[model samples]
Target: MFCLLLSVMRRIICSLATQLVALIVVIINWYQWDKEVEGYIEHKAVLCEFMSSALHEAPASYDDIKGKYVFGRTTRPQFFSMLHRYNVIQAYTQKKEFVWIGISARPWFIGFAVLQFGYVSVFCIQLYNTVTRESWKAKTTVPLFGWLFGGKWVSNVHGSVGPTAEGHSVDFSAPFTGQSAKIRFVGGGLEFDVSGTVKKVEGLPSRKPTLAARYELSGSAQLPKEFLGLVFPLGPRRAAVVHKFSAVPLSRPLSVGIGEGVWHGMGHISMDYTRGLLRRDTRWCWCTATAPEGYGFHLSAGTYDIGGKSMENSFYANGKVALLNTAVGFRKVFEKMVKAEEENIDISSGDTLRWAVTGDGIDLQFACVDSHNGTVHCGVVDGNLNHSWGIFNGTITVNGIVYEFSDVPGALEQHNMRW
Candidate 1:
């Protein structure tokens, strides 16, 4: 009886040893994988920072600047992030093994692990679809990841410097920058239907001066929901394809229609006016993109700098534009939260922009000017909030000029696809 009891005791000890060994192995493997993933994420973050910075320094229009910079400017880093999203499933699998190590300690571990894996897997699949140029069917679906995991994955490393150009008059070229693209839909009691063509005459490098024309009429009424529906869907990926025909000259005291097709969408506009000793440099830029389902699926990894602030800003479908402006104050609304239903933005211009956004659509309203002398442009309407895939609508008044517009493209399209 004593021998048998000792044998049983030995067996139990062996079993416990084996289990401990297994647990240790699992932990080591998990640690290694976790380190790898963390490294990958860090690398991606760096690349995003570099791209954003480079693009900020790069001229908005590559007109006079040689196409060499445009071409030579490497997008390989951005492409790397795209590739990572494709491999995310494999990455998650490898990472989840580490999660299993923790699972052995608690009953809830298994459920948590499974849930995390599933969520990450879905996100990876959607991200892959977005980067691979799949059908637009998943456009709204993929941005949902942004709503779910945007804050965790992306860092808001930028912010807006006070007004770069407000009230100061300057000539605006055809909108070349995606964030800066302007579409004018004239409606409401507003005049000055000034649209003309200009050719680049001097101060250009390798490329020839191009000619562009702008034609718009402004009057205001309650903007139609149908038009709002179309316009709201186009904001996030807001972009335009400029067919260069003639050299367009933008001189001071000039307000040239930047884009030929004026499509207005619901988003934000920022103007900076600064006084300097040598000369006055004014910058007027607006960022508008569509978020149909309230969040975009693909991640925007790039660099941007308007004037004083250089940082990374990411726009999610949750009606939130993450501004990583180091020079200006900003914040991340949702952290570790799955989805955001509403977003309220208070701009430095003392304007409050509010959005009721969801996975299905978005409703946006802001205060603009009543006529053009900086009054209040306010109204409420509903449309496709998933504008990140190219849709959106809104009425905007810049210095008292009112425009009712729709169907403005998104900035993401410019980075990922050629539309």
Candidate 2:
């Protein structure tokens, strides 16, 4: 009885604290600065109009000054150069090499990283089998991240298969220095490679043109340092410049063997390279889905700066890209069991996880067959990443056209980090 009472009291305190924070944010952004948020929805609609035009314009590169937000589906070398020029010892930055390659109609995801913050240099590699729900991850940290000496850059990302109580493992390494449109990951049991070419837009094209092996995306967004810290009292502001590229439904033949299973099929590859001056504590939610006939969407929410003018939400179908201008919301339908002994729940049995991603013209439901949870505690750096893989079902109404989807292969993720 006493423990139950304590839990109730804790719940009350948490609820009150949440309400207080919401009140403060509303007062700061909406009431105090009335002009900024007047007709909020209508304002967002106008911004979306402007965004659509800008995407159509599709500037080749960002201006060197850096403050304005930009969007597009092509790579900008100037953005990469700008990130490398800014030096903030307290800030963290990374160039992530990520790929989601489909084999034999099955999905496999890979992640490799070269990151630096202060004097800490971190490298990471993650592999996931979406259908089987098996994952392998490894990371390492060193004192000195890298160096640029006499116009030459030098560093390396190195990792090995170590002792694991269960599941699979692999050893991998790649050069961390410089940028490359072509990337290769060589390891003890895996060989994967991707060749990328820039898709250039000569003029203001009505629709984005496809490339043989399109390999880059450029975007920028402003976000607050802490979760739900849109108001100044919570945390300072931060910015991120990102590059993404995709080659969906690759026509070329690809085959791979993992464990005792072998997969063979035409594959798909997607990659993201990000650089940010982020906060010490941050949290975000992200989801991605790839459907047949060149349809896919990327949805992300959490960590918006004051005014919330910049958003990262877009979907592409049949080679035409459209922006989702409204805010996105996420609700977890399958709750994680907190007290196993009392609840009599077996987490290993793999219950179907569900999440509803909804917005003005978007409604996406992701149902997971299996999930992978990872937690790392390396002193000051503590992180939790939960990933669930399954299918998506729902409808999105865009420009008066209702797009219906059923049983689309996708993944949902919840990530929290403190560094």
Candidate 3:
């Protein structure tokens, strides 16, 4: 009993210490915004920034940037608050803030996406918030007999709060510059406490991190509450400032607990952190995958092409990230008023999903094993979202190292929104 009490007290102290450190990091980032902007400008002007081994930081403001460019690797989100009003190129109707994390653990896959939109006009300011979570546990059995009596399970949880005057309630770290990202969300019977970390590969160029950046974290998640199947439906554009890090394998395995079942194993994690003034209507289709041997890739169309030199399409291998400089295409995808072209990938039409994605150095096929989908139409905001998980069979050659993988876990997503 005494030991248990001491352990609880130790956890409390650790929690408090973590929060205090996060708060301090936020404060320091807020004060040193200018220095971040300088680094962004300096790197943007260099033609070799994409191949530079030096670590870079996200700029505090896009006010001074002339054109769009890609970073060598995923950088911090220090300057995601707002675009400079005067240098506005795109007529953004609303401010959209989004963060998504996808995890792939063998026989079980989990994903979460949180989005907040603030529609500001001369008369009134409105806010719309939505959180979506999905988890799947694959069925296992004796070959033929298992196929006869199969029981595969999946859970979808969704929450769409109203057009309230209240401010944003989710507390997300601004800089997002750490080795591990902590994810904690609790509401209406759904709870999550997950941490994702990435260690720099040996022999890679050293990075110049910003002031007081910590690169280590540990975390866990428990989903004891029942899943709420509520649904509602819910985009804009200025420069469409976006930063995505894909196929980042966790240095440590992530353990997940769902009700009666507990899963503890190694898995790859990806992040999508973006903030910008945006167009009233937007659409996109995306796919990502991770192999057990630390291999991953990301592909998309109708998005991440916001008139910039950089794109969010790349593959991961040898503990390094290589950018893809080619056009991507999607097929059998829906678009309300916008037309979509399929250049690199083709999606088949049927009950099951199949994807044939090919590029300059990538040739891969994805077949769906299970899927989850939801739609929302609440008068002013509406959207269609489809998320699927399956196996990846193909090869990606980067830097002469051929990563030939088969039967690896991956996902495909398509979304169209009007807000």
Candidate 4:
């Protein structure tokens, strides 16, 4: 009778264990399914609206104007709607307001529930480890995965700006002139009530081969709490943070070398200024000056979104004027190590009229010149190789003439490092 009782007890214990295992598996599958479904639904809605708005309507703005006209496909509200759809983010919209959200998950809860179950199926090993004093590896994988998936979210209200206008031109001295203001990317969740001025200096016939001047440009953006690490990543899974405010002042002047023909100073001079000249010629040359007293010219302002395989190159003789539109193609020309810096860099392309630009940087090798007495006093800086501090060298070729510029100044000091 005692032996029979022991057999029945063992059977009951085994049955209970089996039921527990089944229940755990069901729960795990259900949780994963739920999270995935939620993510999918949210992402679909966000992408649809975001793309649609960007293609059809003028970009939305924080404030409304009575008669001003704007053009773009997306609106501010539509953009926010996409962000709100994400479970990890919360969006807030208010006039003159900035905000951000923070998100993360608990480590311990994820561990006990998700990682350790794989070993549970090995009943014999479990039993042996429990009976013998052998160490059983507790699943520590879940907690590590949780930490990797979790992060903080933040936002801010700071002075910011975006691409307000898109067009082609030769002179960018006053590109912002008459152009309505708008915000582009609002990373870092910061906002600012900022204002700035644009100045211009025209090239005079009596001046020497070069034109020069200075300008001051200033603005501020409001910062949100811990709203860093939200910028568009420069590389895969890698992010940069804005640790502090950067302000830069620029100062620049144009220096031109007179060539043959009726060319006045550095740029082409024609009796009648025609916009179609760029289409016929392959190279051009011009110069410009900055505004204010000490500040330099800044070429950081403007947008260049060329279709794949081609690059957009522009020169600003004055603000809002385009001198040359050169199509840039990239090719490997040469590679060598700089002895002084101990760095391996390439001087990619052969000396030719072809222009090559990388990412946000621009490179323009003058392929044609049509301006007559167009001695425009424009800012000259190396837009391609310059760092955020405006420390780099650029090569320019005009009508079979070549020139090199380095450490060129711009309108805003903060923009010195940005190309």
Candidate 5:
């Protein structure tokens, strides 16, 4: 009888594995059309040319960038609706903010992100008046290294609220995918009133986001013409257009506080504004930066979807993008950093996390020295985000010219999203 039960369990496990493999193959073919593949090679060549031209200097802002990364009439929101509105796509919109600051004069930082996708959103903000700044004690996640670690810690003794994410109460519009979005949330440690509009910027492909907010402060971005873009397949069909820029000010001058304390600081904010028709159980790697070279790189690959086709592997630098279909695995290059600090490193436990990128002869590596910042934890039937911004070092060889990074600051992330 025991043997029979074991045999049945084996069969079930085998069946599940087989189904999983089949799903992956379907996802691969979904985005891998011959025409698209052919176009990709041309796009890469154009991107590399732009990168080569501006390899020596960094643009002050997106204004200083120009290239063939412009979107045509077909790339706009209206064009998509007109073309595929006939039950050809399942649209989804998501807005996420990741704020990590190098507080005051100390190396310590405290920050979190508010993630909203589909009908669910998670507020990772401690929502507290003033969070205690400590580096020794692991905040929520157990810390790994000392000097290399950079993140915020929510104290347990202070009896502070962690993060809150659940089904929202607001009305979701029908398949809205644009830079103009308005939303307000009230409750717990999270209360926000903000309206985002599109503003025309000089010398750019399109009008990006100009945020009008109540807390923190107003912000804007002249998003570059080039970006990490992908078009997914049919049946619960998903497509994504994502742009990332670094902004700041997670909290304001204690204006909307519940208990009356102080909350204000400055750090790098990775504002990921995206419009997509997402599939279930999808995963992607997305990271960005604004300084030390005005770099913006992203990779979107996952399980519900395969990374092999219609993938997002574009790196933006000095206002141009270089396509890297296989550069998503550049994190492996970070192995050298780990080996150098072997005395204090331990990746087996996942305590010593890594974040990196390599492309078209350009490679970067960094480690999440500490894991103080809590997970971008989302609820069930939703997705979770894991990313950390920290100091890193490596050499980027553009056209064989080496530009070294010395403790340069940036971020790296992996997200698994569901709709």
Candidate 6:
């Protein structure tokens, strides 16, 4: 019927241009003229009141330059243990990709990402609220990928006002170039626009809800950009400014309609473009998955301008990449991961928390199951992060075979933006 009347006039002109940009973002969030989003929403509402005073006790007294609405000139405490370089000749590159349209027996988990830096271009819509362990994100930044030293011609609209996400209550991160990271084309990609809601906070414990789902993910990816890639740099100026990853999935499953739910599984995507210069007070541990000889792994025990070349311990399987030379003590493997919740003495609430890592030959085992710790305002000063969604049990011998895993699906992280 004439293409269903041009898809209902393009969904009524994109819902009246998203209700006129949500009525001009409720009048610029009531005139808070963007001081890097009023110092990241007053440093994430003082880290959400220090994460609700961490469920009971802790986190009082914090004043390093008036709680970060924008800070620098960290009063050189003797050059703060020397080491601060990320120039890579005026670098500031970026490139991205993310794909996880899952199905481990149905019940949905969708994520489609994209990004291109310098004169901006971003999109991220991640949803994995399969009834708890909450997550429903959204992001958008425009300028449509301009180039040549990439700057100027910008636009923004950040998210999370619901879906149990009590962070980013309208920030514009003004005066620009504040890349606290936080993807491309294929078989027809790039289309998203969904807006908020996921209440439950009046008195907590409704599985602790208070998130907003303001997603606007777009897409595109169909191979060839070297089929599966990498481009190293983790030192000097721009201390690790280029990480190109390409996940090639989706040969079978596909069914969509998120919000009032309807999503199946089996999907993988990728896009990565990065331009350097970022390193100031660090602590990192980045895990990636969807395996079979390799499609992820990035560990860090330290990186202050990747000085001695741990280059973020690399390993990307099946298509190849093996960069590793040092840095993997993860602070003595986090003392064997804080003894994994005291050896999971019968972990309740949809349980799953087991940890292991062994020998100079690696004998790993990780089964997370669920985790979503938060405390935003990243890039330092009380910026915690623990976003885990599990499944990684047994074997990993690589060229020596042994590669085994039953529950498969993966993603595990541990972050502390210099806490």
On TM-score, the candidate that comes out on top is 2
lDDT of 3 by residue, 1-419 (tens): 99999999999999999999998887666433322221222333342543453223433323236433323333232332334442211222254555555666565445555444433111000000111122222211122221122211111232211111012123222222221123433331112243322221121112111222112222233221111110000111123545455555554566554333345666566555455554456677788877767667777776635233226677665445676776665444323322345432222222334667766677777766444444558766687666666667888887777888677766777778886
lDDT measured at residue 333 in model 3 versus the true structure, 0 to 100: 30
Give lDDT: candidate 3, residue 358. Answer: 68
Kindly list the per-residue Cα lDDT of model 5 for residues 295-376, writing each as its tens digit: 4444444421333522444444555555554544434333443464443333323444565565555466765533322233
> After superposition, which runs of candidate 1 have C-alpha atoms over 4 Å from their true positions?
32-90, 93-391, 394-419
Question: What order do you get sorting by lDDT, best first?
Answer: 3, 2, 6, 5, 1, 4
Q: What digit string (tens of lDDT, one per residue) describes model 1 on residues 34-96?
A: 122212213444444334434323332121233211111221111101011113433333211
The TM-scores, one per candidate, come to 0.24, 0.53, 0.52, 0.24, 0.43, 0.25
For model 2, how does the per-residue alpha-carbon lDDT over 1-419 read when each residue is reduced to its tens digit?
99999999999999999999997886555322212222322344444533343433333222336533333222112222122223233332322212232221346544444444544544443344555545443344444443221111112232211111011122122354222222322221123342222222112111122332222211111111111001111111223444333324444445444334445555444433343444456677877665554556667786432244224455655444565667788776664533323322222354444679988888888876444455668877688766555568998787898777677666667778775
Cα displacement (Å) at residue 256, model 6: 12
Lowest lDDT block of 10, candidate 3: 121-130
Residue-pair clashes per prediction, in order, are 80, 1, 12, 81, 2, 39
CA lDDT of each prediction against the hidden true structure? 0.22, 0.43, 0.44, 0.20, 0.34, 0.37
Stretches of candidate 6 exceeding 4 Å from the true structure: 1-109, 112-116, 124-237, 241-259, 262-275, 278-287, 290-404, 411-419
Give the range of the ten consecutive residues with the poorest summed lDDT in model 6. Answer: 73-82
- lDDT score for candidate 1 against the true structure: 0.22
Query: Clashes in candidate 3: how many?
Result: 12
Model 4 stretches astray by more than 4 angstroms: 1-84, 89-327, 330-419
